[model samples]
Target: MKDKILIAGGYGNVGQVICSYLAEKFPGKIIAAGRNYEKADNFSKTTGGAVLPMKLDVAENHENSSLLDEVLLVVMCLDQKDTRFIEACIRRGIHYIDITASYKLLSDIEAMAGLAEQNGSTAVLSVGIAPGITNILVKHCKQRLGILEEAYINLLLGLGDEHGKAAIEWTVDNINTTFDVVENGNLQKVRSFEDGKESFFSEKLGKRMAYRFDFTDQHVLPRTLNIKTVSTRLCFDSVIFTRFFAILKKLGVLNLLKLKNFRRLFVKVFENFRLGSDIFAVAVDAIGEKEGKRAEYHCSIIGHKEGIITGKVAGLVAEKIYNGAYASGVFHIEQLFEPEEILKELEENIEIRCS
Candidate 1:
C-alpha cells in the first residue's frame, strides 16, 4: 500500500522540523531519507521510532528503487540540479511538494505539467516562507483589490536565525546576479541588491530600504495571478546590515561573490554571525481597482525562526495533499489555496495584518 511519506534531506535543519511535525500526526508513516544513513538514523532516534530512517539519494535515479514504490508522497527539502528525480516521482503517480525557491528549476518542472496530469500526480512548488507566505499574501491582496494591476513584495530576514548552508549559499550566489521582473507588462533587467526602495514592514520593524532580489515569487506570480507587474525586494532586519549590502552592490564589490573562496567565506560568516533578531517579515502592496476607483491593498506577516515557519507551512500543505484529492498537475501555492486558510494555520506563530 503506497502509504509512506518520504522527505528527502529529512535529517537536515528544516527537514527535521517537517519530519517531526508530520510524524506526530501520521506516526511511523514518515520516512526521513538522505544519503547519510547515520545522520538519518540519528535524527530518527530522536523521534522515538515515530519516524523511520532511509538511505536514499535524490541525485541518483529512483526509477528502480523499491522504497519509492511504497511512497505515496515526497516532500523535498534539498536543492536539485535537475528535474530527473521529480520526473521519476511524477511518473510513479506520487504527490510532490518542494521547498526550493529556484525560479529556473521551478519553470522546468512547470513545463512537465502535462506529464504530471497524465500520471495523476500533483506537484506543489514555492512551499517555503518568502515564496510560500509571500505568494499567499499577494494572492490575498489581489482578492481584496479587484482588477489587480501591480504588486510589490518586500522581505525582511533576520541575521540571528540559524540559516542552513543551502540558504546561505543561495544568498551569496545571487548577490551579484541579474534577473528579470515584470514591469508595465514587460520584463525589465534588474541587478541584485541595487535600486533600493523603502518599504514599511510593521510598527516594530519600521521602514527599511529593500533592494531587488531574485526571489522566484515575483517570476511565478505574474503568470499565475495574471498580474502585469510584480517585484520582490529583500532586506535584513538590521538597518546597518541592509545598507552594507546595498553599498557593496553599488561599489561593485559584490561581484567578488562569484569566486568560490569569497562565497564560502561569506556563507561561513552568515552561519556564525548572529547580530539581528530572529525575525522574518513579509509585506505586499497591491494596486488595482475596487468599485471602479483606484485602490491599494496591503498585507504583512512577522514571525520568528523563518526556517521553522517554512517547515510548518510545508508540513501543513503536505497534510492537505496527503489526505485530500487535488487536481493533478504542477501548481503554485496560491493557485490552489486561499491565504486565509494558510494564515489561519500559522496564526499562533506569525503576526499578520491586512488592509
Candidate 2:
C-alpha cells in the first residue's frame, strides 16, 4: 500500500492546490483531513484521491488515536492556538510539514528537537514562501559568503490571487506590527508598510516595491543560522492599496479593519481591484568574503502566486521527508534538502538569477 499522507487542512485554499498536486502524482495515497469532513471529502472526490477523514482536532485536550498511527507523513495546513498538533506528530514519530507563520507556536514546536531526534522523526516548520523560500535563499547566501556582513530579504506578493479565508485571516491577524529586522544586532521597529521601498525587476510582475514586515523565519533563521544581521520586508502588486492600507495602519484603524463586515468590503474591493497579478518575486542580497576576498551573491526568482509557490515548496519538502530523501530530526526547510535540488524542482515556473 502507498504511504498515507495526511493534510490537516486539506480543503483550504493552498491545501486544495497541494492536494491536487499530490493526488495527481501519488494517487490513492492521500488523507484530506480537517474539522469539516464534508468539505474535505468533497475536495478529495474532486481531486480523485482516496482521502480518509479524521477529526484530529488540536484543542486544549485531545488524544492521539490510532487513526494517526498509520500515517507516515502529516502536512499541517491548519493553524492551532498552541502546539498540540505538532506535539502529537512528534510523539508518534511521524514526519510533519507546516506552513504556519506564528513564531510563538514555531518556538514551542522547535523545543521538541530532542524528542524528534530520539524518535528519529523529521519535522519541518515554516515551510511556506516567506519562511520556506526565504530560508532557502538565506542558507544559500550564507554558504556562498564565508563571513557575511548582513542579509536582506525582500518579498513581493501577488495580491490578485483569490486567497482563501484562512490565508486572508492569517494576513489580517498579522496586520499589526511587532517584529523588527535585525541589521548588525540592532533592533529596528517594523511598523506595517513603514519599511522603505525596494524595486524588483522581476519577470511577469514587472517592477514592484517591498516593505519590511515581521515573519516567523526572520526570527528563527538569525538564531539558527548564526547570521549576524537579518531583515525581511514585504510588498504586494497593488501600489494604491498598499498606500491606503499603510495610511490606515498609521491612523491606528487596522484593528477596526478586522471586523467581518470590514473584511467583506475589503475582499469585495480586492476582487474588483486590478491591483495585482498572480506573480511573485524574491530578492536576496548577501555581502561577505569568498576565496579570501569580499563577494556578494544576488539571487532572485519570479514565479506564480505566493501561495502556489509556498504550497509547492511545502509539498516538495513533505515528499522528501515521506520518501526518506531528507534526514530525520527537527530541521528547517534548508537543512533538510539541497538548495540546488529545490531550485531545480521549481525551475519550471521560477526564473533564477544568481551573481
C-alpha RMSD by candidate, in order: 0.7, 2.6
Off by over 4 Å in 2: 53-56, 60-62, 186-188, 203-207, 251-255, 258-274
Q: List pairs with backbone clashes in candidate 2.
A: 211-234
User: TM-score of model 2 relative to the true fold?
Assistant: 0.89
Predicted structure 1: lDDT: 0.92
Q: Give a tens-digit lDDT track for model 2, residues 179-214.
A: 666667776666655656665545555555666677
lDDT tens per residue, model 1, 19-80: 99999889999999999999999999999999999999888888777879889999999999
In model 2, which range of ten residues has the least summed lDDT? 55-64
- TM-score of every model? 0.99, 0.89
Highest TM-score: which candidate? 1
- Residue pairs clashing in model 1 are none
Candidate of highest lDDT: 1
- Residue 204, candidate 2: alpha-carbon lDDT: 52
